[model samples]
Target: MKRNLLFSCLIIVCSSVQAIPISLEYQGFYQRLKQVNKGHYSQVELVFSVPNKEKCRIQSGNISTEKESFPLIITKEQRLFLPFDEKLKSDRALINLDIQGETKHCNIAMQVRAKQTKMEYTHGDIVEIQAEMNAMLSEMQGFPMRYFTTDIAGVSFLFEADSDVTVNIDGVVQSVSGKLRLSRAQILTLTNLKLSLKPKVISPWTNGD
Candidate 1:
């Protein structure tokens, strides 16, 4: 009887440990970075692809580097954003997500490779930038999407978009890719620089059905 009881307990523990949640894949990018009064702030957009038809409620999340961990704030729409220290020491970070209905944690390894360019104030340059930003905003409005922002110095803007955008940085043409969503602060940041907007396009596939 004692042996049987021990075997039963071991089986239960093994089964619980093996019952991990389905892994979710996500693509993240830096949308923008700007200089503030005392320091600089940045924003990153993460697009998550939930497995099967499972719904994800982001109970909590964090970004971990080699030295420190930064907590992330998630909006009702599932967008995540956070601020980091001035000396961002790593290009690679680990994202840990604590969601409901999972015994084990769901994690993703993401590459922080989004385009970053300084703003130019030339009349023609500003006009072109404004037009592009406006078009992106108009397209993303009213879509069920997530948004996040971070206030960290020295980290460049990166993001993953549904489509690709062409940008010229110091005379070099480059492409930025990701699904775009703009926070009110992000919109204001662009407006203050006189270069307004970003992108998002809604599709039936996004519903996760």
Candidate 2:
């Protein structure tokens, strides 16, 4: 992922923004470093001290400039991998973390990777898109968060977040990908209808299907 992924997290909200408690340790020594990209640039090896005594690392480098554009690789166990750009390409990017009300902004120097172009998707018609998505999720139970569907005709969803989700468009299902996202109001409405799933001690090892 591009280093700007972390930078994009720095959105400027008019109102106070709350911050997530993502523990970032700035005092640890990196344990390893290697070049994983095809290009040549400086690389940094990041090391972390996990609560369980387990360690993880993320390999990062740059292309031509000294700036590193790769986002920190975060393991599933909550270890934050931070990279320092040796060239310092961009020093003006600000990151804003909004959680409940408190907001904070910091200037972090970084670099971005070059963009590779491929065939793009033209904005599809919204009315038809909604119809297709509702039909696909018609039999789906529980509050759907976000998932991919390669069964649609020819349509493929890039990255579907908690918002910016409508219905699905059908055509060639070859590599068609789709995602399902619900809104706050929609969740509340689903709850009012007595269709909410209470949280439980679900085990990841067991499949609930």
Q: Give lDDT per model, in order.
A: 0.32, 0.25
The per-prediction tally of clashing pairs is: 18, 17
Task: Single out the weakest 10-residue window by summed lDDT for candidate 1.
Answer: 3-12
Strongest candidate by lDDT: 1
Give the C-alpha miss distance for residue 143 in model 1, angstroms: 21
lDDT tens per residue, model 1, 41-84: 12222133222113334566676666777776766645545443
Off by over 4 Å in 2: 1-23, 26-34, 37-83, 86-117, 120-175, 179-209
Candidate 1 TM-score to native? 0.29
Model 2 TM-score, 2 decimals:
0.19
